[model samples]
Target: NGVMNLSIKDIQGEMLIVSQFTLQAKTAKGNRPSYIKAAKPDISVPLYEAFCKSMETHLEKEVKTGVFGADMQVALINDGPVTIWMDSKEKDY
Candidate 1:
């Protein structure tokens, strides 16, 4: 589900949504292509745990997440920040 679907209110301040793919990768092949299709508790359990914890630490608030599965239902109310992008380098500009 996209962030657009998530209903977030800045009752305190803005909310930041971080996306990390290290937990989802295909090391079985030479190149590390995304293996998100292969869902295994052994691999995802720790990753998801650390992810939620880190977010709470940084934001000092509960970081919500979607269920891990194809049949998961996602719905959100349209608010603001209705956009997206991709950042290649971590340039501190």
Candidate 2:
């Protein structure tokens, strides 16, 4: 079997951690997405923070993050196959 087993430690690039609370959205009832199942920020914030901290520990470096609970706009230019490298030296907007 030509299966490639990879780990986060093997990634030689920066990690961007975004908190997507919409993952818990329930759309079974109606067209509008209901976030009733989502954890409130009071609970989710700590979990999100913990996850980013854990990832930083695993990668042995500080991970980049977006503003929590803010309406943010992200633009991505995915050039190659699954990997997009951004120069970390650039200051975060």
Report lDDT per candidate. Answer: 0.59, 0.80
Please tell me which predicted candidate would have the highest lDDT against the true structure: 2
Whole-structure CA lDDT of model 2: 0.80
Candidate 1 segments whose C-alpha is farther than 4 A from its true place: 1-39, 85-93
Q: What lDDT does model 1 reach?
A: 0.59
Cα-based lDDT at residue 10, candidate 1: 32
> Looking at model 2, which ten-residue stretch has the lowest summed lDDT?
77-86
TM-score of 2: 0.73
Give one digit per residue, the lDDT tens place, for model 2 in 4-81. 355557757677888777867888988999998889889999999999999998899999998889888876654234
Write out the backbone clash pairs for model 2.
none
lDDT of 1 at 16: 38
Q: Which ten residues in a row have the lowest lDDT in candidate 1?
A: 7-16
